[model samples]
Target: MIRTHQGINTDDDLKPDLTPLLDIIFIVMVFLLLTASVKLQSLDVDLPQTDTRTLQTTQADPITINLMSQSPYWALQGAAVEDWETFKTKLVEAVKAEPEKPVVIGADKTGSVENMLKLLAFLQQNNIKATQLLMEEEK
Candidate 1:
């Protein structure tokens, strides 16, 4: 009689394969790429170079809000506001008054991210959708 020893192939003895996990990761990546919003962040608010301009429309000019951290100033349409709360209230009122009008944010490079985030949150909470970034010209 000959005795043969069989090798164990139990789950505890075998290592889990990573191929399925990699496949799942790839699938998630593809889904995100398909559903993600793609915007030009590098030039998000950068001013464009234009030579000729057409006549302006009757639509209300977008309100421009500038943020400066070093000096800590808030401006609405080139005029300075007293405080952030006031700025937020005025912004809300402006949007409420003219839902169709847009808000343009001119953020300084030295500004705090908190300020920008606050402004963004305010706009989002108010259901304002016509907000845009304003960048200065590169020189």
Candidate 2:
């Protein structure tokens, strides 16, 4: 009468209890949902007032300044300035003549950083704010 086989009950042993896992998953999901559903508070940001004039209208012709990689490391309008003193004097005069003109600076790839920084410092001291750096595109 005792014909119950214990070997046939392996299905129950092989089956793992997923109730705890499911409960943990549901709790995590509920937490995430609650956190996501919370109203986020943000302040009203002040928008900046931009200039209405176009570049062509305001900036007629940019004063191009080139920093060469060679001995004469400075050039204004394709003409190389002999020395730093000359370069500063010439640039100051040019800036004063056309204060609204934006200075476009283009540095040679092989140029030293020292020259570049010196030029920038000079421009800063002269209060030349409107400036642009020209970069050559790789061909």
Query: Quick one: best lDDT, which candidate?
Result: 2
lDDT of 2 by residue, 77-117 (tens): 66788899999899899898988767877677678789989
Off by over 4 Å in 2: 1-60
lDDT, model 2 = 0.69
Query: Candidate 1: minimum summed lDDT over ten consecutive residues — where?
Result: 38-47
Tens-digit lDDT string for candidate 1 (24-118):
99999998777554332121232433343442222236666777665435767666777888888887887778777666677776677888788
Task: Rate residue 1 of model 1 by lDDT.
Answer: 30
Instruction: List clashing residue pairs in candidate 2.
Output: none
TM-score of 1: 0.52
Q: Distance (Å) between predicted and true CA of 32, model 2?
A: 52
